[model samples]
Target: MAQQYTKKMIRQVFVQMLNKRPLNKITVKDIAEACEINRNTFYYYYTDVYVLLSEIFQTELQIVIDKYNETLSWEESFIVAAKFAVDNKTAVYHVYNSMQRETLVNYIYNVAGNVMIRFVENVSEGIPASEEDRKLIASFYQCALTEMVLRWIAAGMKEDPDTVIRRIGQLFAGNIEASLRHSAALHDS
Candidate 1:
């Protein structure tokens, strides 16, 4: 529990620092000073700032996943996730614009993929969908959502979260059902 507390403190400091400036510009010394911990203490929890950033992404991704797992509604889950980004615009924008963007992109892809797969599974419950078909469908929607969110961030996240969520909800409303039915039909034949 103490370790967890320390790690959270380190992450909190890193996030605070990240919001203030770019990741590359913020060094281990900066984080250590902010956290009031020694450099070695920071190293004890993370190898470097990049690793710390990756862990932050992973932590947030897992939170989104856990929330989705509970409700299994992509719309609600996505809105919740989007709200996180919207609320932490400075932190998110810093990461998005930083050299560590690939890390953010990869996290987006994985989270999008997981959300898509869970959504398809929930909608297709009782329907038999081959694993391959499920993967293909999930990948398709994952790419679309990931690209859309990336574009939104690139545009400075100017759009309201509701507008973005509503637009995406509209685009994908019937598509999942259609794909599930098509997959089931192909399996029957």
Candidate 2:
């Protein structure tokens, strides 16, 4: 519990600091001071600000995953994700305007990959999906999805998530399974 508290404190400090300045300008010392810990303690928790940002991304991804994995369609899941982005727009924009773009993109890649993987697994249950093929398809889908999201964020995240979700669902309707098959066929070709 104490450890959890410490981690939470660290995360809180990170959010507070990010709200105030660019990520590159915020040092481990700044985080440590804000969290009332020494640099060593900060190092014990995270190697650097990038790692800290990664942790935050994973935590947020897991929250969305854990909450709606079984209950939501892929479109719904994406809507939830967009909502998460919108809800945290301030923090996200702050991070976006920081030096953590690479870290942030990696985090989104993992999150989007996980979502695509799960969606494929559920929809393709009992269908034979080679691990390589699954990964490739997931990678493709994740890349596209992340690009869309990055654009959405860059545009100030102004569109309504439900509308965005519905449009994406319509655009990709039936293509999810078809795309997987097409990708598998291409791989096997």
Candidate 3:
């Protein structure tokens, strides 16, 4: 129990510090001082700051995945998945502007990929779309979603998520089923 609390405190402090400055500017000493623990304690909990950052990414990814894995509403799932970036803009931007931008991009892609895969599965529920076709459709939308999200992030995330989600939905609202049907037809032929 105490160990859990210490780890949580360290995460809180690190996120708070990250919110204020770039990831490169933050050190174990800063986290240790903020958490009221020593540098060694920080090391005892984490090997390095990147490891802590990786854990944070993994935790957030898992949360989003678990919460929306079976969720059929793609738009709703996407908006909620993007909540962390919109909420923690500062920390996200700091990382985005750092050499670790790949990590952030990969995280976004993974979230988008999961949402797209699940959404496609639900949408093609009754269709005779082959597994390969379903996955191809999912990959198509996932790439589109990932690119839009990365562009949004690069542009400082000034747009509302609802509007973005709506635009995407509108653009491809019936396309998934249409694609699935087309694929099924091709497969049948």
Candidate 4:
């Protein structure tokens, strides 16, 4: 009888392969061999390996977001989210170098959005900024965070992630509150 493998096992094998080789060089047959699953089983679930890659990013990043949903600190949330890429440098580069790089970007965007919204809410407790404005602020920071992570990936991630995250926190310190206060004052006037 063939052994049954869960998607988590399949995903780990796929990511391990990604760490070792570029996405373009990875084949379903190779995945099957690495996974020790029948090619038929692989085919049954995905028409293309990229489909599985996309699914892995979406599922994994969503887990990160859900896990940090209660966190009060956006910077801490970003560090945790960014750690995935930092830890999986080769795999991340493989995905970033592929045609399906948008999947990676979307994952970062989702995490950034999640953290930023929570951050804005935490800081805007007594502020009079409309929910719309608060959301706008979160969106702004989300884009910034996404770009920061993308740039780090593009630059080969030579910088220590904690240092980078800490510097960002230092640079942006009080900026969110200032932005919210400005929005409220503008709204009042």
Candidate 5:
């Protein structure tokens, strides 16, 4: 059997390659070479570049979720997430500029959606939101967050993510909750 490689090793190699080149220009051979492993070994750990990309975002997102103690606000949680992306700006920009941008966008949207779903559900724990409405609410949050993050990255990731996140919180503060309630009411009626 081939020697098992740890996620840390894969991640380190991946980040190093991303720093020097675009995602599309990065071949598994490049990754293997950077990590001093064979192409087959890289394949053993990841089927393709996109899979590795998704796992990176998912891992960071999971960390954001895990850091919250259930007492903090959604803004705080979102800030944690946004900061993670900002901290990984180079890797993010490489991925964002690559052919895999669409897939990466989808993953980010899914992550944002999951976070918003938790927030909305917790906030409206006693409210009666149908499954469809709940999904709509989550989708809205996901779409909004994904677009904002993409735009932020496209603009060179110049602004502070914390500032962007705070602005988002300020902009959506009461409106999002009201919109959710209104959408749920409309669906029920």
Candidate 6:
């Protein structure tokens, strides 16, 4: 419990610093001073600032995943993710424009991949596609979604998530199951 609290405190301080400045500009000393913890305490919890950033990304991704798992709607899941990025605009922008952008991209890819896979599986419930086919289709959509979200963040997240989600829903409506069926047919033929 104490360890968890310390980790949380370290994360909080890092986030505050991230919002104020770029990831490259922030250091372990900054986090330790801000958290009022010693450098060894900070190092004990995290190997480096990047590790801390990765933990933050993973924690935030899990929260989004858990929330969407309950609802089980791809659109809603994306909205949750978009809202998170929008809510953390300053911090996100700082990271997005910094050297650690690949870290952010990786997190987006992973979370989006999981969400897309679950969505395809749920929607294609009655379809007879192989597991490989499902994964391929999910990967296709995951790349699209990840790129879209990255572009949205790059554009300062100006567009409303509801508008974007609705447009995406219209654009991809019925496509996952259709693609799955088509792939299954091709494999059998």
Q: Positional deviation of 80 in candidate 6, in angstroms?
A: 1.9
**Candidate 5 residue-wise lDDT, 1-189, digit = tens:** 234345568777887778777888888888777778788878887899778887887787788778865686667877777775666678788888887888678767866876888887776666676767777787788888889888989999999878778887887787657866786688679
For 4-95, candidate 2 gives per-residue lDDT tens digits of 89999998888777766777788898888888888999888899888888888888888768866665777777766666566667777778
* Model 5: residues with Cα > 4 Å off, grouped in runs: 1-5, 180-189
TM-score of each: 0.93, 0.79, 0.94, 0.92, 0.84, 0.92
- Candidate 1: minimum summed lDDT over ten consecutive residues — where? 69-78
From the highest TM-score down, the ranking of the candidates is 3, 1, 6, 4, 5, 2
User: What RMSD, rounded to one decimal, does every model reach?
Assistant: 1.6, 3.1, 1.3, 2.2, 2.8, 1.6
Model 3: per-residue Cα lDDT at residue 49 = 92
Over the stretch 34-118, how does candidate 3's per-residue lDDT look in tens digits?
8888899889989999889888888788888888856447888888888888888899989999988888888888888888888
**lDDT (C-alpha) at residue 61 in model 6:** 87
Candidate 1 stretches greater than 4 Å from native: none
Q: How many residue pairs clash (N, CA or C atoms closer than 3 angstroms) in each of the candidate models, in the order given?
A: 0, 0, 0, 0, 0, 0
TM for candidate 5 is 0.84
Best by TM-score: 3
Best by lDDT: 3
Kindly list the per-residue Cα lDDT of model 1 for residues 127-147, writing each as its tens digit.
Answer: 787779888998998898899
TM-score, candidate number 3: 0.94
- Off-target runs (Cα >4 Å) in candidate 6 are none
Error of 6 at 102 (Å): 0.8
Cα lDDT computed for each candidate against the true fold: 0.84, 0.77, 0.87, 0.85, 0.77, 0.86
